[model samples]
Target: MATLEIRDLHVSIDTDQGAKEILRGVDLTINEGEIHAIMGPNGSGKSTLAYTIAGHPRYTVDSGSITLDGEDVLAMSVDERAKAGLFLAMQYPVEIPGVTVSNFLRTAKTALDGEAPPLRAWVKDLKSSMEALRMDRGFAERNVNEGFSGGEKKRHEIVQLELLKPKFAVLDETDSGLDVDALKIVSEGVNRVKESTGLGVLLITHYTRILRYIKPDFVHVFVEGRIAEQGGAELADRLENEGYDRFVTSTPVA
Candidate 1:
């Protein structure tokens, strides 16, 4: 079984005001087939943790260790990290204006596997995954995320996740801006991928609504760049009712 481990991670960003630390000694572990939900208020460094794991150039890991199994993830390049089975579904997926969805998926798959997937099998898998995500077949010819709705973009991200079959995925606020129906559909897509591939998930969200559909084995409360508390799925219920008021002094954006 594969495992991702983050130990005392400290990350910073270069702002106009110089380097400002975002993650302060964060630590966590995710084993294969485990779903870990990280719920927190705004500016709690939840997204920072996700970006750090995905090897985003904006975030600087000053002192820490990120490892997949025994391999050092911190030392790997961004594409190298993806090849090592670490995937990040960004909060705002960028629009690739010139790249069609089919081309982008195939290119990414080829890069990760070090070989081109046979055209017939690749097309079959792509069509099947898009159908499961309720994506229109026409999307295959459309430029990636070009003029797509928020839900559509999120669904496309899941399509990548399903097709790529990553060992671990860091979903950053995937539930954001999704309507009730869209949320259910997207959540089901994630659950289906996990069931089929035993994919480990580190889901970051501000509400418990998504948790109801994608039940996490562990719930972590992130406060001020650190994990303030941790518990089982029941912890999400408490957050739904009580919120993070007791954890922090100010009212956090839910």
Candidate 2:
């Protein structure tokens, strides 16, 4: 039931001299059940766009607005944004030294649902979801992402997605550092979530490997902090074959 609307979103980071702009006027709208893939070069501000939408505190919004279900999201705090149904799977999963996966998941579930699910039911659901993602049972007992492998961390994020069932999710480079098998498993988990929950996805990545398993509804080429071109899933294929040089070099700077 959430509609994500971004209009001319411009973001900058504070520096000693002044602010250095990253995202330059990005405009996008994602409906409840659509998958939109954003592919860009290294400094194209792909992650910046994702973090900005999820209400990260580091980046400052210089202009434009982000709305969720007709409510102004930029006005909401990070906690309020999550409570309002926006989720972000970070590229670099954070390490929580004292928080076990089960505990963190339970806390998130409680926060989102406004009540704690019984321990028995929570464990049952957790085990089932972990199995579905081909994760080990030991994962639940370990501190969240403290010493997890690249694949394990990524899978854990997917587990959070399954448990949270967020309306809108921004997957920021989830494919990074994943092996071939890991990539397939991650993509499968993402596809399962989209199919079962009707969740809207804004997948941001630099590579096309992940797109093979989870075909995007739309693909946008991001260059120099702005979207240069957009097309169907075939655009991903084209980029894979031709590379982003042509797109990036030809794109005008903001």
Top candidate, metric lDDT: 1
Q: Kindly provide the TM-score of model 2 when superposed on the true structure, using C-alpha atoms.
A: 0.96
TM-score of 1: 0.97
- How high is each candidate's TM-score? 0.97, 0.96
Off by over 4 Å in 2: 249-254
Local distance difference test scores for all models = 0.94, 0.91
lDDT agreement of model 1 with the native: 0.94
lDDT of 2 by residue, 95-188 (tens): 9999999999999999988999999988999999999999999999999999899999999999999988999999999999999999999899
lDDT per residue (tens digit) for residues 1-254 in model 1: 99999999998899897898888889899999999999988888899899999988998899989999999999999999999999999999999999999999999999999999999999999999899889999999999999999999999999999999999999999999999999999999999999999999999999999998999999999988889999999999999899888898543321
